[model samples]
Target: MKKGFIFDLDGVITDTAKYHYLAWKDLASSIGIEIDLVFNEQLKGISRMDSLERILVHGGKEQAFTLAEKEALAHQKNTHYVELLQALTPADLLPGVKAFLDEARKNAIPCAIASASKNAPFILDKLEVTDYFNVIVDPATLKKGKPDPEIFLKAAELLGISAKEAIGFEDAQAGLDGIKAANMFAVGVFSGEELHGADLLVERLDELDVLDLIRR
Candidate 1:
């Protein structure tokens, strides 16, 4: 039985991906690089610095900036992203999110956020669901990002559960891979065909019964 839940924040909880894309797009443009929604998809479930590094490499400017310069660029992108996030409201919570959360809460299931986003807390606050989570694993504290299992394992640990007893929800393949690597049941929340190894796949969370999932 799954004793706890771990979720990816951006695409799983809310649609911060747009804001991220916009911020990155602007930053890339300023640096004489161009990125589209397709390219932005690769940035999902990764750290800001890693995403920036990818963007730099995509633009053929990977070695053009020093570590300090890269940090500054990442900061600039975050500043813009944060500004965009101010527009988020509880209404922005994705389809079936609140209902699923409520179901988990009713059953006393511990829930933790295991997102790549450093702005997870801020986004949670904006969505007015800060109290719903038992833990929010800090990406800054993790040495490795998604596809490494570190974040998911840390979240399960913080929730006082074994990784095998936790269920992880993600919209990105990297996050799904991480959950599986952590020995947790992987729940994929995307319509894409790429999430091949998920234990369960849904276009959205509401399609799955919370109690049923936990009992599996």
Candidate 2:
């Protein structure tokens, strides 16, 4: 039975993906690498530095920047992203997100965030749902990012649950892969071909039957 729920913050809880895209696009354009929404999808669930490296490689400028330069670029992108985040409020919670979190709370199901973004806590605070989660896995503490299972595993550990006892929710292919790799039941929130491997697929969290999921 699933005893806990682990979530990916960006797309799963709120729509920070747009802010992320805008920030990355701004950075990419400044670096002469133009990226559209399609390209931004590839950056989802990946670390900031990894995303920057991908953007650099896409522009054939991967070898042009030193590690220090890349770190600076990543920081620049994050600064803009945080600025965009200032507009976020509790009302920014996506459809069914607040309701589902409330249901989870009523059911006494522990919830944790396993996002690749280091700003998960800040985002949660901005959304005013910080109390809904029992743990927010610090991306800085992980040795690897999504598709590596490290983040999700760390979230489960911090929640005082086994990976197998957690149900992981994600909106990206890499996140779903990481959830499965961590031995958790995967719930994909996107209706995309890339999310085909999820054990339970839904376009929104409300579509999931929480009680049934827990009993599985």
**Winner by lDDT:** 1
Candidate 2 lDDT, 43-109, residue by residue in tens: 9989999999899989999999889999999999999999999999999998999889989999999
lDDT of 2: 0.91
Tens-digit per-residue lDDT, 1-216, candidate 1:
889999999889998888999999999999999999889889988899989999999999999999999999999999999999999999999999999999999999999999988899999999999999999999889899889999999999999999989999999888899999999999999845378699998988989999899987
Assess every candidate by TM-score.
0.98, 0.97
Query: In TM-score terms, which candidate is top?
Result: 1
Off by over 4 Å in 1: 191-193
Q: What is the Cα-based TM-score of model 2?
A: 0.97
- What do the candidate models score in CA lDDT, each in turn? 0.92, 0.91
